[model samples]
Target: MSEAARHELPDLAAMAAFGARLAERLKVGDVIALEGGLGAGKTTLARGIIAALGYTSEVPSPTFTIIETYDAPPVRLPIVHADFYRLNDPAEVEEIGLDDYREGAAMIAEWPDHAGGFSHEAACLSILLETAKTGRIAIARGGGDWLGRMP
Candidate 1:
């Protein structure tokens, strides 16, 4: 079974703080699978993670381009930020060379289900966001590799 943790995102600031915590433990080959309905904070948390990674510029939504990459110096490590919302099929992931972009890098994947999902990976940290009466809730889960790493 996967390990799981819960977080309360009472506000954007809290969500961003959680992102920073998540970033501290990030490493190569890790995949942060973000899941939720539209406007449920998937992209918001992703932006937070990117920002915590040391990316100073704006993080445009990958809703159009599908994928965005950030390298070292600006970021502590290489990262592939992908939004699979535009993907018509899981096979499209291959066509776009998703694996190539993931080489030697961590990934922040939005709409991961559109790309066949990444939860199968031991290092894949899947975060499911749900809109709450007040703000939002984050449910994070992972495999053995994330046993003690679930933030």
Candidate 2:
């Protein structure tokens, strides 16, 4: 494990800016595992990332849908946004064809712990968000390839 980088997001805008920075470093096969409690800005951060990728429309939370996908043109690359909050087991990932959806795309995974987590991957960037009095605190820990590329 590498040293985690800490970010202070004093407001929504700051969060979005951080998300955009992360977006600039995104690539195929990358897995961004967002960890946080409810209302910790996980979805908000994910939306910012998608928007920075060139998505002009509203980015909804995948809490109910479980998964949402964005392709190139509207975005620079394919992105799979998934919320695993409802999953009872990591094995459910196979049932939902998560691998198939990730075939050629990078993924933004919320509640990743429910799906076993992607921290083991060389391209995985695990961001843990904690609500603070002013806004939020983000502790980001990325794998080998992402160590020097963290946003």
Error of 2 at 75 (Å): 0.3
Clashing pairs in 1: none
Q: Residue 120 of model 2: what lDDT? A: 96
**Model 1 compared with the native: what TM-score?**
0.97
What tens digits encode model 1's per-residue C-alpha lDDT throughout 1-151?
3756899999999999999999999999999999999999988898999899899999998889999999997999899999999889999999999999999999999999999999889989999999998889999998667887779
Model 2 steric clash pairs: none
Lowest summed lDDT across 10 adjacent residues in model 1 is found at 1-10
Over the stretch 1-151, how does candidate 2's per-residue lDDT look in tens digits? Answer: 5788999999999999999999999999999999999899999999999999999999988999999999898899999999999999999999999999999999999999999999999989999999998999999999987977887
Question: Residue 46 of candidate 2: its Cα lDDT?
Answer: 98
Query: Model 1 off-target regions past 4 Å?
Result: none
Residue ranges of candidate 2 with Cα displaced over 4 Å: none
**What lDDT, from 0 to 1, does candidate 2 have?**
0.95
Question: What are the models' TM-scores?
Answer: 0.97, 0.98
Each model's backbone clash number: 0, 0
